[model samples]
Target: MDLPRTFTIRESEHRIHNPFDERKLADLGAALHLKPGMRMLDLASGSGEMLCSWARDHRLTGTGVDVSTAFTAKARARAAELDVAEQVSFVHGDASGYVSSEPVDVAACIGATWIGGGVAGTIELLRRSLRPGGLMLIGEPFWRKTPPDRETVTACHMGSRDDLFALPGLVAHFGRIGYDQVEMVLADQDSWDRYAAAQWLNTRRWLDQNPEDELAAQMRAELTAAPLQHILYQREYLGWGVFVLMAR
Candidate 1:
């Protein structure tokens, strides 16, 4: 099956789905100190950029699992584009409860923690695929500054202010899970804009091209409305980070 058409279309258009840029992701790869032939397991691996890039940069091997058929296809194409097809594989499947048949050096679930419900459960799921002393990478959101109202909180995808931890609280949550926070890279507002605003432009362009398509109308409506919603509610309140965790 495919992800919702909106998301599928976004992926196919090569829009950034997370608030991370190429430089930031490269910095994360450096922090990991990836070595040749290391194996990585990536859950909810959208477009498989992380795994595919890791394979190319570090000479590693890996498998990425995602539920989106469209994303999986794009991941395969990306692997080929990077000339790393032989080093990485993508599976179209649910990442929830997914465990590697063999332990991996790194297990990651970036920006898709729902695959394991939340940070704690996601870590446990990733740990099952990681060797002792191996690392887990979790990309999650936090409150940059406490939002002033329920509307702002909801736009940031939290039920209430308490639903989102501050950055320090997020680190402490990892500590409670028996993993030490080794390294982290955060997304600034610019990065967030790149991720969120780019999609609106893409959707707008698609609407122009496919005026008669059933989904085009919805996409056009979203394109018209999303920018205001994001700027008003999300840009100021939410923060995102990718943290590396190691068993303590």
Candidate 2:
């Protein structure tokens, strides 16, 4: 009913919990031309930022489900903070195989497709709750370029080069799967910096406060190495984007 403590600790203060900045997120919502009262179902909806923000900005109604109890609570607090609590709800549970009780105008699983094993399986899970002609959103990583070696691939936190497609291949993948890629918003290097670099600071601050905690040693080791690893590998080799899809 919750994420691993280490995962929560690493992203303790992240609101969006992905590479997307607030502006990019807002732009995505606007690009969808979401209407008032549209219903959205968000699976693996970390911190519920997408649902809560869209509910406030677009006047949409949504439900978000996540396995992280801490993140789920943060999401509910975020909804209330945005004064959109009445428009959105968050559930703390597994997102895999989750289908909205009512068909929804949009179904999404952002940055957590592993919940359903991968992009294709996650899309199938999301489609179960989507109304015909409705949209689906998937946020995922791609290879910016083919890594030169297995070491580079491992440094980028992927098991193999096959773990992610290049940008063009990713688009082609959607087409092959009987979905049209209607819209996409990509994260620039700056967005990646914001998402990754912020964790160092969060980890450092936590370490300073919880020096005696059992996880402190691991956090310290990560803080010592993550920035260099990210700058050298992830920033150069990985690209991330949120794509909007429609069933063909």
Give lDDT per model, in order.
Answer: 0.87, 0.94
| lDDT for residue 156 in candidate 1, whole number 0-100 | 80
Model 1, span 1-248: residue lDDT tens: 55898886654566246999888988999989999999999999989888988899999999999999888888999999999999999999989978999999999999989888889889989988999999899999998888888788877878789877898899899898788898999999999988888787778777878899999878887778789888987878889999999998
lDDT of 2 by residue, 147-209 (tens): 999989999889999999999999999999999999999998999999999899899999999
Please give the lDDT score at residue 164 for candidate 1. 73
Give the Cα error of residue 47 in candidate 1, in Å: 0.6
- Score residue 231 of candidate 1 by CA lDDT: 90
lDDT of model 2 at position 157? 83
Tell me the number of clashing residue pairs for each predicted model. Answer: 0, 0
Highest-TM-score candidate? 2
Per-residue lDDT for 70 in model 1? Answer: 80
